[model samples]
Target: MDQPITRRDFLNGIAIGATAAAASGPLLAASMPDPAARALPGASPLPPAAQDAFGYYPPLLTGLRGSHPGSFEDAHALRDSHTWPTATDTGQEYDLIIVGGGISGLAAAHFYRAQAKTESRILILDNHDDFGGHAKRNEFNLDGHLNILNGGTLEIDSPRPYGPIAANLLTTLGVDVPKLIKTTQNLEFYQSLGLQSGVFFDRETFGADKLSVGLERGPLKELLAQAPLSAAARAAIVQIQEGNIDYLPGLSSDEKKQRLSRMSYEAFLRDVVHVEPAVLNFYYARTMGEWGVGTDAVSALDCWGIGLPGFQGMNLAKGSIRRMGFTPAGYEDTGGSFRLHFPDGNATIARLLVRNLIPSAVPGSSAEDVVTARVNYAQLDRDAAPVRVRLNSIAIRARHIGDPKSADQVEVTYLRGGQAFTTRARGVVLAGYNMMIPYLCPELPAAQKDALHKLVKTPLVYTSVALRNRQAFDTLKVHRVYAPGSFHTYFHLNPHVHVGRYESPKSVNDPILVHMVRTPCKRGLPEHEQNRAGRAELLATSFETFERNIREQLGRTLAAGGFDPARDITAITVNRWPHGYAPEYNPLFDPDVPEAERPHVVGRARFGRIAIANSDSGGAAYTDTAIDQGHRAVVELLQG
Candidate 1:
């Protein structure tokens, strides 16, 4: 009379036995979509109102943007109720099951194949509709011509400093460093095109919507000379530009370093340097683009590390002045240029990895050709393929099949098109964001779960706008401008790199892409708390709000340049990432723990057939870190 003991029932029995409670009906009903309706053609993965007319993915019409509602609802419901559907085993098995389809997970598949020395059956599942994760590419067809811009993960910084494993991975992926160097745009050439650094002060924030160019000689210095500021503030500005710091006395070199490392840059500028409020205001907005927080959240040492004018102790000579350069330390410009990049940024790397792992998904032989390759999305998860990537599939649960020591297989359950499905694998890799791991695998040790939770992802928004021409930018005589107190912190013309078949725009009238960056960090909050508040703000923002902000900011700033936002701006794509940058060491908040005792190192220890891989696992946000972590995870699983 009882139902037969299928795998799904058995798993459900195990879950129910573990926690003596049934699945909540309302939660399950709220999370699950109508399966019958979802099967229809062109049915949106999100609610109808959330889909934008032009933008990719659901636009988060009312809720969060990056990690939107549907992506987290089911997982949250399961976690809260301590119940999930009995995973219906599809009877499919793989040699490896990767929990993310980002660069790290893709690299894990590559490393696993190399270790086995054979083409292994691997499955990669991602919650997003598209692959590449944060290395996103936005393409537009304007006036019958293709315009591409990077949505995130812009470049491979300082490839020479890469570790042996990372360098070898780059070589294996067919990245020609010499060829890339040759193709990258020269900075001097950009400056020749009347593109130079400038700053814009909004009327609301600085009492005037004024644009200042040529800070060294022309309007900027004159404006500072005549603007509202005390004599001490003006002197401090000059001292900062000239790298002269004589204010703090009676301190040894080590003592000065320790003081700077402990104090906030804002505090150092106001308290130590004795700068006025206006000067502190100017300094606050300087580092938002790179650090995701203002000067207050970052320490004085970080300010100096990013080439900000603060570490006068390093340049003790009275006549010597440290320039306000953008380049980070140890990454000086090679031949007066930063690094090479593709037209669509590092998305080319993701494309190359996909081509190698699943040859049928893309058609490309080298990195150069990958820029224009057409991917066959329909073939990604085909049954016949040895390696497959399944998009719009969110993994909700992962567990060992039997005893931890003796279990030979791991099972993973995920949601696809509103339905739940399960698959088995010889090994599993958790290569997604660190915060979500605790909810996915509740069986992890309490300390490991707590350590994983300690990682807080920085939130950022990268918006690209397609324009009819570059006349406005040229008229303004500035290609890049930093907006200190606006919704968008920075805006610039796309990098002019002519590589492969893609050619950079030549004429001023040619359609060009304008990229804007914004990192949401609330002031007066601790590092982790600020990240949490920023994530909430990002989620609460709507597409309409974003569009409105963009229009107002551009129109006001470019009005003097004869720019009409309504006529020139053709399209806008806002790529909101709630979990953008990976967690790194914070001098103010994080303890000076040894490498062996760090949370990331302890949490990443291999557990049975499962291993961890991601930028967060390595405590750095570089592309090489992701690759190294992937390699380590694969090696760990093989040895275990």
Candidate 2:
């Protein structure tokens, strides 16, 4: 649906940081499980293999879980006396106080502690109980594979080199970067994640009449070429061996960087690679699921930046791990085996960081020293910052105009429990999305906010649908990529699909989850009005609606492939993300923003002491980007 309607009868109806209600009729009851126990069912279980494959590890099946801000600070107070300078003599007035405990916030915490081993008072305040903001981790115990599953920021690719900040972390963590470059391991990694997909072309040449087995080819050959492509396809499996893809036109220059920034991603692919229309659509669907932007809206610059430097037209690697038919034995790190992750994506990292920041209170302390410990998603309603954490805390502002010499010292404010609360800090790092900037800094110059708004990321809604013990495509291979108009993401999970298949148990009769992410219209009245027709039609797709769709698709595929329907189908679980995906498709580069445009915000800044940070700001909205921004924010603060 264009706008996912809030439902009352849907499974665990609208998780508002509370117990979920059951759906109207369900064959199997799936309750939220502990974070430590829920893991991604298919592809790589062990940490080593985890890095090599693409897909979320430790599936985020439910709401957030971990330490809250209040308790965390109290623990620090008791652990170090200087932390609390007030009458209580606890760690309160920190040398460095960070607001908004998202990925960037946590990464800042990690960087500060790691850089300066000397226990400098550091306090991190997040409205949410869990650290990662958009990067949420969920846990569910359904059939057998029960561990922390990732709900957002699913995977990281290698073609895009890590920025300085992320590279620094990799060095600090001592991850073997070279391993990811190799091919044998990378190919196996692709197979493990069911990335064994390809663009089916009707003709050997670039533009063909027929596509996807029987679908008629659209007349938009030029448009279709500008779609997303797999690394191998873009390089034409040729440029990698030559290593000169970066010399393409519209590249190697800063001014013209935005040259490809205006057109749709599909347009860029067609203009660059001159590939077949069918292959373009296949790759386009994968990109849509990954970036939440369709070919039409996504910018060519973003497409180029996100993809390998040049070689714009290409298909994703499939079956085997040959980028361009070359055995990238030396480029292991680019392959699947080099992926690094926590059991539950980066949420594990957030937990570790949160633990280090909080004071370690004694197990059985008295009521006086007990410092009330409350961790709930709704704590923000109680002005919970005074108490503890509110799960869904959204930050609105952070800035420091009074002290231009050091913008580090700042004021910040955020909304918790649906109410606004402000805090003061020595430094503030805004790590939220760019669109959120307008709301946080309401007084910001219209031009700046509007320009940033132009960089709005395509909005997306992800629905994780699980079908239990129903093998409709038994005859077909377990993994296969679908064409456009069909569900964007669908793959088998458990026994047959996971990495380390030999060691991991299989489930012929167990439930397998299929994750489907669709593009949703942007927020605000304009988008809603524009998408009213689609919204009405899509609103009917409840868990049952999804089940019926899958059954319909499965019936067609199975009938063609030859498989039993009734005996194979089992149960289903549907998880929805309404306000997901960043809004910017192609970002505009405005190097200099006027000072007047930067206004004091309610939650964004507090007397140059607190700042905000999230992918909501500019730059690629990834875990690494958040980390880089965190480091930049801290550096700015320390300088002041």
Query: Model 2, range 1-640, lDDT digits (tens) per residue?
Result: 0111111001110101111222233334333333234333332222221111222122332311222122133322222442222221122233455556676776776676666545655445554444565555554444655423344444333223566787766555433445422311222332443323322221122333222221122322322343344444644423422245442354434333434444455665566555545434444443455444445444444444334224332222222222211111112224322344332344544443343344231121221111111112221112112122223344445555475445544455444333444455454455544445555555555765664454434334334444554343333333333334343233323212121211222334445544334443321223223134223333434555555544544444444444433434444434333334433222322222332332211122322444445554423445665676677666655544
Clashing pairs in model 1? 64-539, 242-321
Q: Evaluated with lDDT, which candidate comes out highest?
A: 1
lDDT of all predictions: 0.69, 0.39
Q: Candidate 1: where is the Cα deviation over 4 Å?
A: 1-70, 75-84, 158-160, 216-220, 223-232, 313-338
Model 2 spans > 4 angstroms off: 1-97, 114-129, 144-148, 171-286, 298-343, 355-390, 395-423, 442-455, 469-474, 489-504, 507-511, 521-607, 610-612, 616-618
Worst lDDT window (10 residues) for model 1? 7-16
Among all windows of 10 consecutive residues in model 2, the one with the lowest summed lDDT is 6-15
Steric clash count of candidate 2: 117
